[model samples]
Target: MDKHNYKSYRIEAENICVDYHGKVALYDANLRLKAGQICGLVGMNGAGKTTFFNALTGFVNISKGKIRINGESLRIAQKYQAIAYVPQSEGIDSQFPVSVWDVVMMGRYGSMNILRSPRESDIQAVKDAIDRVDLMELSSTPIGNLSGGQRKRTFLARAIAQRASILLLDEPFAGVDIRTEKLISELFIQFKNEGKTILLSTHDMIHVREFCDLVLLINKTVVAYGETSEVFTPENITSTFGGMSPDVLLGPES
Candidate 1:
């Protein structure tokens, strides 16, 4: 796609602050994500990673500052067409009796004509997304029947099917098996190769170091933001994680 045709900056968050109830979650966080890059947001628990994701996707109303996608500020409803967000939840209620394919099909609702039902092409896109995530065989199964990793893959398929330019994933690998994690990492690389910008928040420093092109360290604020190696240094990691040794968290550099 031509540079002018596609968005220049996949997503930009400028001086954004978010509050839940009376407490502040993210404070003046600024971020710039480019097309075709996979970036990681790392921080300890309660450090505002998810809150930042919510703010960027407009899921949570911002207390201050602005967020833009493709140079345009996005409203909550409008954001669904441009970005795909996968929260940390394992899966929706298993007893709800939703099929995996149906769940994936929901991703296309953002762009679908509300007056009309989904057509054959939409079904094909859902199938393609399931295949991309290697869930073709299980596409007919109940989402509740799948394992934690499989559930993650299902949501990833949904995001892929959305055909959004930007993806925001919150702890996607949490509770997932090692094999699923590897598969998800490979899928992320494929998305990057296709020029889709990806931003993910996780505590998995090892995967972040290995896969992310850029790293943003957050602790209710922007602590360090730059290349993965540079920001993952002992001092920076220690400071961000509250005096925890980087070696222990990063697992003895290469």
Candidate 2:
């Protein structure tokens, strides 16, 4: 764990490359995001959006280059649980024997002892997170019984309870309703106000434009990245997704 300081950039990746066996998933990838920012990670399917997130979390082997979170090396940052990740809803099994409270409490495991016991502070954190997500009424509900939006909020509560400086969210808006979308959008702004850096991948360009001031566009590699106003254009979208307009992806199934 190198104690290197990366200034104000809460998340930074330099010349990263990911190889799945002999197949290269990502190459020549680079990104830097400052604290108090929301960045939309947009790319085509199988274009390495998840691969980039995995590289940052050290869930995948980085074939080359480095990533830093909170100005420290990714390995060290990850060791301290510096980043909180909320993966796509499809990855989680709702049939598991877990309550909303049970899932939120998992966030505190990183701070607990070998027995994984929860302290008063941990309990309070979980409660506060659940409250923030307005899920106190359903806190005791089994995950399998929750609706799509409630399930999404439960996982978001988990991330909130983790209290990490950086958050990586994959398609948070995928299965949510209009009210849930509004809640999430508000939460993003609140997180930014708290100086928490967030990077979320979404196929919907409308949400990206409405929620993020910055955007990172990816194809096989990062084609363009910067302020959304400048980088998110017809030409860049055309380059990244190959002739698909931003409107075509706004459908519910896209």
Please provide, for model 2 over 41-126, each residue's C-alpha lDDT reduced to its tens digit, 9 standing for 90 to 100.
99999999999999988899888888878778877887787899998989799899899999999988888899988999999999
Residue 243 lDDT in model 1? 92
lDDT score, residue 230, model 1?
77
Tell me the TM-score of each prediction against the true structure. 0.92, 0.94
Q: Model 2: residues >4 Å from true position, as ranges?
A: 1-5, 245-254
RMSD of each: 2.9, 2.9
Candidate 2 — what's its lDDT? 0.89
Highest lDDT scorer: 2
| Candidate 1 lDDT by residue in tens digits, 8-42 | 77787889999999899989898888899889999
Residue-level lDDT for 172 in candidate 1: 87
Clashing pairs in 2: none
Residues forming the 10-long window of minimal summed lDDT in candidate 2: 245-254
